[model samples]
Target: MNKELEHRFVTELENNQNIVHKICTLYTNDKSSHNDLFQEITIQLWKAYPKFRGDAKFSTWMYRVALNTAITLYRKSKKRIQTQDYDSVIYKIKTDDYDDTEEQQLKLMYDAVKQLGDIDKALVFLYLEDKNYSEISETLGITEVNARVKMNRVKNKLRTILNP
Candidate 1:
């Protein structure tokens, strides 16, 4: 990439690195996996940066690229391991600021979220981030109607998991 483009990409990426972190946290269960996925997403973003047309917000474009990377490129090499009901593996990175009750509830929610399939998890993540139907549709390449429907289903699924 040329200097101007590189500078722009770095500045934007630095400013919006939280998008990458959120995606990584949702997709990876452990620190090693999280770091690996983060690195992978960053590489993919760098490669695709030249194609970004700036027709959308930089953060919006970053969401699409990061979600695509998490869903498609990053995968665990080991056979999946069975985990406990409230797995702490994923929550290890969380700060101790949350009291025990809050932490337990959060862990349960995270565990429930982990049960969702990749695409559904992406939808849930977007919903939790307060992304509207249009933004979620654009990011995931679904129609707005489909995004709304899918988000409803995801919400229902989460409720079932949390309540059951």
Candidate 2:
């Protein structure tokens, strides 16, 4: 709202933009849709910034807001065409040092992840980000034990999707 708060919000958003980009990549299918989602998420974040009490870390709070915005908008944005290839995608689901075999496996895993439900996809994304159970729980608004249980289920689901 005010200049100081706006400056702080912009600074924080810039620093943690990767989180938003990653969410947009997973939730969107095409470049135009991805840009639209990113803009919507940024607007939502700006609108809600005034209420950010900073009780948790800025990134942590951001995860909640960003994920929520993605899930909400994704449903409304179903008109966007779902493209298959994301090679030019900005935030790819890739890990450094992945060999050819690992790269193929990663593609399979990414496809499986893309097919997942919103909460399950969020759980896997957080897990891949190396967020501990506590952080995943906090970000997803679930208890730690619930997070673990759901993660286990998501893993099993992914395994089934990948194998079959």
Candidate 3:
């Protein structure tokens, strides 16, 4: 890549590293695995950056690549994620926005989300991130209706997990 393209890619990746870390956290059980997955996603992003067009927002384009990288590696793994350090993975939730009860509920919800299948977990994560159905569809390569329907099913699944 040229200097300008390299510079741009680094800048964008730096700005969006949190997105990659979040995906890594979702997919991996331990800090070691999380770091590995993050590096893999970054490498994949850098390799594919040349083909990225200006058609969509950089972050929007990133979701597709990052999610795919996580899912693909997840499928290739032999063992399930054993355990996640909830404190380590969950950086923080402010007291102003959420009380103790709400924070506990959020942690429970995250645990439930972790039980979902890989694709379902990705779907739920994107939905929780406030992505619209259109963006979710585009990111996951499904139709808008499919994204909405899957989201409804995911919500029901989470409810069952949390309430039972």
Candidate 4:
């Protein structure tokens, strides 16, 4: 990549690094796995950076690439050991002035979300990030209607998990 493009990619990636963090958090069960996933996602993004067209927003394109890396490539790799015990993942909530009740509730929600299938977890992550159906569809490469349907199902699933 040329200096200009490399600079652009770096600047944009710095601004949007949270997107990668959120994906890593949602997909990985522990801190080490999260770090590994983040590194893999970054490498994948860099490798594909040259092919990025400006037709879509950089963040949107980043979401597509990041989600694809997390969902498809990362999972298939032999290095990842999938874990089902969501409670093993630690959520670092700064406890100074934090309400215990609220923190526990948030932990419960995260635990519930962690139990979802990979695709459902991605949908929930996008929804929680306030992405509209269109953006979710574009990121996941699913139809808008399918995104809505899937989101509704995920929401219902979460409700059941929380309430049951």
lDDT values of the candidates?
Answer: 0.85, 0.89, 0.87, 0.86
lDDT of 1 by residue, 1-164 (tens): 69999999999999999889988878777777788899999999999999999999999999999988898854453356734334443456646775578768877887898788888988888888898889999989999999989888999999999988
Candidate with maximal lDDT: 2
Poorly placed runs, candidate 1 (over 4 Å): 74-98
User: Residue pairs in steric clash, candidate 2?
Assistant: none
The candidate 2 region of ten consecutive residues with least summed lDDT is 81-90
Looking at model 1, report the run of 10 residues with the lowest lDDT sum. 82-91
In candidate 2, what are the lDDT values of residues 16-73, reduced to their tens digit?
Answer: 9999999898887667778998999899999999999989999999889989999988
- Compared with the true structure, what per-residue lDDT tens digits does model 4 show for residues 77-134? 5466656556555576676886689868877888899889888988998888999999
Clashes in each model (backbone N, CA, C under 3 Å)? 0, 0, 0, 0
Candidate 1 lDDT (Cα, 0 to 1): 0.85
- Model 3: per-residue lDDT, tens digit, 1-164? 69999999999999988889888878877778889999999999999999998799898889889999998998887465456566676676666855589768777877898789988998988887889999889888899999899989998998899888
User: How many clashes does the backbone of model 4 have?
Assistant: 0
lDDT score, residue 81, model 2? 64
Candidate 2 overall lDDT versus native: 0.89
Q: Please list the residue runs of candidate 2 whose C-alpha ends up more than 4 Å from where it truly belongs after superposition.
A: 78-104
Q: After superposition, how far is residue 2 of candidate 2 from its true place, in Å?
A: 1.8
